[model samples]
Target: MTLCPSPQFAIPDTPCLVLDDGAPSLGESLHCARDWAAQLPRAKYLVLLCERRSHFILGFLAAQMNGMTVLLPPSRAPGAIREILDAYPDSACLVDDGPPPAAAVVRNCRDFHPIRSARQPASGEVSVPPEHVAAIVFTSGSTGRPRPNPKTWASLVHGARLAIRRFGFDSRHCIIATVPPQHMYGLETSVMLPLHSGARVHGGLPFYPEDIRLALERCPGRRVLVTTPIHLRACVSANLDWPAVERIISATAPLDKTLAAHAEDHFKAPVMEIYGCTEAGSLASRHTTQEDDWLLYDDFQMTVHGEHCRVTAAHLAEEVELADVIQLKTARRFELLGRHADHINLAGKRASLADLTARLTAIPGVVDGAFLEPASVNGATTRMAALVVAPGISEARILERLREQIDPVFLPRPLVKVASLPRNATGKLPRTELLELYERQVMRR
Candidate 1:
């Protein structure tokens, strides 16, 4: 499908982004994009390191208009940024704050002054080729090294349209996302949704519970919170009065049912979970509190072969093989068992590392935690271990609570206590970091 310049619901005066300074009209955004594109350095790719949503939106649109593919690093870590630049030597970095990263060329987005003209730019429709590479988003590297996945204009736009319909929200909704724009879920929901579906997004990347509430309160009408399970739990525990919210969309990591229930009750809004990865945008969604089966979005089909599953959609460049072990419930619905790599077999008792981690976090007083089965050494798997964040609770007490929930065979051999898990921006625990922490805390001692 050819790209549409703007959504039908958006007019020239419609707010594309809601910022603390002021909302930028759709027409104004177009004007800014044009101006920004003209000043950007000539490059095949532009690494978007913009923290502010407004800057990210402008930079992304400018790159698209200039035929320069946007490159979204897996994280804002220095190493992650350097790896992308090294891999794509023809790319330039567009940063919003501080010194621009080391690259062939660097463009500070803050330097681009917005047009002070009261006159709006002509919002003309521009068609983008279906096969045009729009972006390359990297995986979170939770399981291994981060890998780049290319997204075409057609695919990104199509995925956004599918989400718009699936969520049953329109331009009237204001999106306040806690996840950063670099992540796939953040890009698809916060960036792509507003640009393609006419919804207005909050410019700030609110993290703390109070900040999120303030951002939501600033919206004029219906509000949608696009966040992860970590943010949701924090909000639910904050016990602060929340503004009216139309819906809460969560992704990244698996959301616990109890947390979802608490969030729904606290915010008085339904909590929805999206199942997808970097390779594919959002594939399916389900109301976490009310449903166990995930309904696939339009035009997407899922097929199961043995223990593995593959997904195909009209907008996808090719079929994507999923890492999750999904149990097909119906033609267009499925249940997530766990990640294929998370399955464990010890003493003939099978368990999922994800499940174990979830159980660990569920224990009273436990703040954050993870279950890791370190890589085998000399053909022998290391005993399963755990890192927990329980302030007052001892490791033995945490283990006692865990034993009550899980089989004895699956209990952590040496439960290590810590302040927090090494979670990335998207609330994903990278295995490499977890292993390092484990070695430092348990093995060295």
Candidate 2:
């Protein structure tokens, strides 16, 4: 399979990125990438630590053009950075702004200004070979230690094309994403979608509801909100009037129907939920308000073998096993049961932690919550515990609502009320952090 269907340099004058200051044309981006690539040392691997979306895109393209593999770590924590560098001993860090992280050779994007090359830039398309490794995206480390997943240029391009077609995006659409560019979902939807398709991406990564609305206001064309369940829920719960958005795309975590419906009603747009993981870029998406099952991407096939399943596509290097437990409705559609790791069996009764968490968040006045099975000591099944953030509602009332939704045997014991749940940037509650919170807040008490 040939990797390059379209050339990055072909669309020179087209508007590619919309920033607060001004829009950068595709020509300018290519020139900037070329300038940056010229200064980079002859390293086989480069670690991208760019916080801004546009800069991240610039570095990504430059690395690709320079024939260097880009390493995208799950986070910029000192430990995470160290792990990535340790894994790729010949790697160097590329930064758009801020002080360079310790323990790696640093290349600042700002230092390399965009300049017109002596030779005229190629007006024609360039093709990246199918086997070339474009990037290495690290897992979220929610289950355990973050692991690296290498993606070929062909796979990235194929996935981007799938998203563009699935969402019906074109040059007329402008994307505003809340997730960071390093995350897989963010990389595909916010960065790759614009480059592969003709869509324009907003440069800023908006988090607060007001900021999100303001970003949308600044955009000139039809708008799309690329965000996660957490950010979408906050936007709806805030009740702030939203700007006109053509549609919304959600990923990073499972979006419940209630939240999806609320977002659709509040924004007056369809809420599309994407199902994927770090291992398989984005495989399927659904309009949550209309469909209960996910529609897989074209040319992708899945095989269910008991509790686990594997996915294969023309873009994928091999059949990749999924951590999710799914009910295969057809060859191209499936209902996500939950993560295999999230299922808990106690006293011969089965329940999914994801389902319980969704139920907890659905209760009125409950802002955010999570249900975790306390670590077992002495090989005994420990009862479930909960950490909830409901300032106005009493713990008794919260439990009453939970009792109505869940089995008494599965009701969380010692439900701890708190100010907020410890959610990461993408709105994921890491199990390690959850365990830490339980040990300090609940077990200590």
Candidate 3:
């Protein structure tokens, strides 16, 4: 909340982003935020493309200095970019090297420049109100359209401090994160933790198992790898001598118990899995091998309401409904029961089926449509299937229009021509029937 940067945090006059190794320093990167605050108006919101760690952190802090909200869009995917662009028409995209090819088609680019001075912003003694929305992050929406969730600076910091305590992050620690800095989990752990603790963060999203090992090799002293279950599995499978790696954090998707066991056995490091989504920064964390309850972020309260999980965030000063279906044990700790019906899983990532269905059914030519996964008829088809209703539109035209909006994974296969999809009393769906319908209508025929 304090506008003045922490004294313990060391800021060098040198560049944060290294062109040779493509690694950016925290101080140098945050300096860009300061520069932007000085340039932009006090109330202008900034839309930052989270392609790299350097750009994400810089854009975030810059918004804070300017007292503007920051919007972080997931990388690369055109549908994801278009959604954010449509949502925030007045926002400017922060493109470091060059504006992304997809974003270029949407609007003119306002290029960002590196900070030249070390002076802090004018609001040195300011405290961001707990109610103020500091940033907006979209849930990856495994089913339909991605939903935007706004988070206050206080809430974000509160969650980060809670994470710092559980993970034992301190000034002496250095991290090499494989996760993108834009997403909530990655943003808090990789960027906020460093600024909060005055620690160093190696800017890299190591993709390959060997790359993860190399990142550790490049960074010394209490190196932690913030990654996913997919990357963790690959890292263990690589069987590299990664003695320098002390801690590992997995998020974004569910971590298999079998893979967690394999990870600790091979790496001799603790595998800590964080639970939460873009909506709630991070609710709690449980160690892979330990039995300790997920230490909830300070000021957070959880309650199971019927089949859904709800949260009372004292930091945000608001109550939020979470996608997770949790078993309420107390206001703080509880076991997770996968996702709520708000999201349906297909091909590893979760999508918003409700949002997709709404979009398809709302179109002019389409009367009513249901999007479901196609079953494996002869056990040959690998992807899910869907059924739609468009009496006048051709299959190619229907697919083309939907493709312009939704991610490819959510795209319906075979484009089953249907009169109308079955809807319940509240126009709802039964999970089993949705899958069954897919099998009968699309798979068999």
Candidate 4:
């Protein structure tokens, strides 16, 4: 489990990061990392709060060089930041382009500049031990309380290498990612992939479809758009003229086959979906339009016993239990049934919430929706409830359409039409938020 056979940055003097201002070479990035590392306070842990992708990578490398554990919060919410700080009292904060949250020790990355005099000692090949904790990425808290998953340098680098090979990426590819840098998908694809695979990443995190189009137009060479299903749906529905995209990568939520086919037809590129979690990183990927089963990455093994399955990889510290139920076709291929926690049985019938939601969003005139299990009152079982955002569509009309697709018992009883679902940056619905919405909107009535 060697971190790197030879200690060195991948490709220097190549365009590694494409920022709004200008593209930064790997050499310059290494120089900035050296300067940033010199200014970091002596702390065992540091909270990385960089909104920009380039700054996030710089901070990550600087922390790695300084031998400090980087704590990647699930979100920048005040409560989430406070929880991490409380968990690690000896931690400090690092900011690149914004004011630091209330903390005793904070370092601003904007203050650091590449120093020529400081280049001698720090310049040259950089390497870290296989066991060094590169980062502690927290889960999305979609199911329960957010849990921290520590990733080692060896694991992170190994995963990056696998991604590079899986995607067939080379120095000619430029990535324009819409997801936030804090999320695991964004961190691995937009951050680590470029560092390890010799590809360049766009610095801007564009959300609007027009902005994404403009960002892609600005990038040169073969381009790859790393985004989620929500963003892809919006982009495809908008029907805006797009540049030549070599490929599109989607994750963080299940991608509908219809949408995937539409995106491929519209963009003239294939849509590759990555299946993974915060605990195991990226384990497998598939082309939604071409395959029903996912192909596992090299050096990874999947073992299933009864209803539970575990994944083991060279980069992983141990075998990780998968949250989703899978139908294993072979050692390297499987079809995802659904999340183990998302399956529910009522009235002697079984259904998956994910499947229901997918069908809900597929209906005409339905923008977004979710199926939730409302809290029971006085030990009385309750039927599934729905929160939807469909303007100018009647609840009866939506239900009429749903009746054709799902069984009567699985259909949502009270389909509460709302403005939108409370989705995080990565387009994942938190269970707590869904419960709150149900209690506020449906329960009262």
Candidate 5:
């Protein structure tokens, strides 16, 4: 708890955000946040749509200071934006990008400058009630429709402090994140961690391996790369000379160990994975190359009965039941089985879709892949189908390899070769999109 930003946090003069031009101190950012908050339109919720990390942080703080809850949409898709806006009638959209997506009272982040030095408020510190609702983060709609999860200010701060200690992060470490701030994983590592732990974060949302490399090069210190499994795979495969990195953190989807090892070898940095969901900001961490069990952060407790697991913590208002299957190894350690949704019972035989997909992607020429179990029709289960991204490997060859590793019941009926999977920024394939792809490519054939 030594690194935890106190409940009555005092703003610091250390750099909080690193931009191409210069680094902005925490106090400076707060000053601008208050100024911008005063001008923003009155609303009960602020739907943030800023692409720039700096703007997102400023908007996040401004909304909170003004007592407006920040609403993070699951994605930038028009349908997703509309869904959130329709649900929250008193929400205003804030965007730094070109134009707003929906028909609402939209405000542009470009209209206000957050880095402009101005007269500091008399207190020079931001203090909000611990019970204040900070943000409502939406779940990634991988399985189904995105659901909102409200997070309090105290919970956010507590999660960040736990992360800082777990990752050995401090003000001296510079964060270069590929994931966008709207995602809960990105919000914790890229935004909240720095705000509470005194770490400096690069403002750019780097996606390409080269962009990530450049972002790391520009920062001066031990650098941490906050990203997802898809981004890590791209970086490892790029084969470009990477900059010195202190560590690499990945989440949003389960990371393949081989890819994690390759990334660690290439970057000469330890690769770590986070295990959590939108309901809980971040729960545990594990060094991928070293172990399969996840070590829960201090004060987190887990209990399992049958296949369902419930997690409890002081920061959480109530115990949260996890959707995934878990095996408790100790009081604070556990092994994560695939999600309940990914478990398939086919022809009296059971198999995990996630495990099968991992096996397919582990093939020599496979770039990416996923196993899809279509909905049952007339009480009869359908054969599972697969989508693969291996230009060098044929559908037959991929199936042959899968046959050796998995049971015959689990082999894909028609493994469709594809250019790419429809992965979002966080590397999650939405079920709706996957089914659409299946219909367009498979049924049409």
Candidate 6:
């Protein structure tokens, strides 16, 4: 009925993993949980992360077994991390080398030893209720900020089980993750999905195009690739024979149809996109090789009201208002028009409006700036554009700052130089109206 960390399908003598590289066995993973629970008996909540995917899986599962709340912010930005820590009150943080600005730290999964060579604590068991707070996930709010939505242990188990059935994964599946485990998509697919479905996990978040090809080459087996749509296009364009992959899953933002088609044809693997967020974890995934219409979650119900998407009596939340804009046909089927808020979808990656604006505002050379996603030919969504201070900064230099902070897709395509952006009575730019400004300033130009 629940996740037991049962590595029933792991290949015998098969190389499993930790933060360093390939370094743990199934029993070793469980043992890590026992040691962690023992070390921090008094801590009720923990936020743990290892730069390695394997350690993340270990810490998260260990926390579940130990009955602690885990906080997951979509981005690793200091602002987001600080907010999560503040919300949790007093909580121990689990970390590897890359840590948040916060104080509490745990053993780096790579270097951490078992605290004992010959003793294993008796397996600790905790009862989990569907209403209990299992993990907290943060979403960039429409009002240019972050908000947390909590999910239960039951939700994760149900979501993982449903995805495995839809994707045809089993113990035979070996996954290489290009996305960080912080996001709901990566956490579910790379960590919980692998553990529950009996799949093996690999390390590192591949950023460059070449690293993806190299990662694929290193791991050999029935491989599944977990990545965002932005990474998918880059890897496909890298002009390398991608490793033998069985399935590819894309999330974060919406996928370009052309890129999806190209990926399947080039990699000779089925390309699928997940319709999900930090709030719901993963709701649906449509096989790009087949159709764009997302196949609804078998375990959850989706309801579209007005321009907002809401769920009733879910494994995760009730009366949950999602950040996604959906068109509902029935209880289980729907189409995504766009997100419900300020977060923009660019080539299947998200750039927080606040993060973008904050960076532009921080650059001393700038006065004021705002980013926009313009509407395009036959209304096929176009690239992002920005309105920046006309005085001190050159357009080329301004874009460089944005590129360092956000993804390439989110960078202003033509770069508009203007006095300032328009705002409503309360100083908000509606999504529909934001595109109008892009049209007048950038697209028409």
State the TM-score for model 1.
0.96
Clashes of each: 0, 0, 14, 0, 0, 1
Off by over 4 Å in 2: 1-4, 7-10, 114-127, 377-380
lDDT of 1 by residue, 150-224 (tens): 999888888888998898667788999999999999999998877776789998889999999999999876899
- lDDT tens readout by residue for model 4, 1-445: 3322332324665677887767776667777787789888899998998877777888888888888999989877778898999999999898775676655478876787732332233232467777999899999988888999999988888888888888888778999999987888888998878887668888778898999999999888999999999999999999999999999999999999999999999999999999999999888999999999999989899999888999998888999999999989998999998998788887778899999999888888999999988856565445888999999799999999999999999889889999888898889887887788878886468
**Candidate 5: where is the Cα deviation over 4 Å?**
1-11, 117-124, 378-380
- Please, what is the whole-model Cα lDDT of each candidate in the order they appear? 0.86, 0.83, 0.64, 0.85, 0.87, 0.66
Best by lDDT: 5
Task: Let me know the TM-score candidate 4 reaches against the reference structure.
Answer: 0.94
Tens digit of per-residue lDDT, candidate 2, span 1-445: 3222555412556677887667876666777777788888779998999877877888888888888999988877787798788889998898876676657888886787743334345332445667789999999888887888999887888898888778878778888999998899998999878886667888877899999989899987899999998999889978988889999999999888888988989999999989999998899989898999999988789999898899998888888899999899988999998998888888778998999988988888988899988856575456888999999899999999989989888888889987777677898877787788877886457
Give the better candidate number (5 or 6) by lDDT.
5
Sort all candidates by lDDT, best to worst. 5, 1, 4, 2, 6, 3
Please identify model 4 stretches exceeding 4 Å from their true place: 1-9, 101-104, 114-124, 376-381, 443-445
The worst-scoring run of ten residues by lDDT in candidate 4 lies at 115-124
Q: If the candidates were sorted by their TM-score against the true structure, best first, what order would they fall in?
A: 1, 5, 4, 2, 6, 3
By lDDT, the better pick of 3 and 6 is 6
Q: Cα lDDT of model 5 overall?
A: 0.87
lDDT of predicted model 1: 0.86
Residue lDDT tens for model 3, 1-445: 5532454433342223322254444444555566655665433567666555655666677667667788776544566677777777666656545556355322212455743345433222335665667888766545345578888877776777777777777656777777777677788888777766655677556677787677677765677778886567667768888756687888776666667888988888878888777777777788867753566766678777687667777665567787766676666677765555546566666665556765665465765566654554453334545677678987788788888888887787767877655532112244554555656765467
Per-residue lDDT over 1-445 for candidate 6, one digit per residue giving the tens place of the 0 to 100 score: 3454344423323344423344355555667765666655356677655555655766776677677888776455465567776777667777766544565544455455542334344332334565556788665442455567777887877778778777877766678887777667777888767666666777666667787777777665688888876577668767787778888888776666777889988888888888876666787878765774676877777776588777654465556677766787666677776554555656667665556666665566876567665555564446766777658779988887777877777777778887665532113344444555667765467
TM-score of every candidate: 0.96, 0.93, 0.69, 0.94, 0.96, 0.71
Identify the leading candidate in terms of TM-score.
1
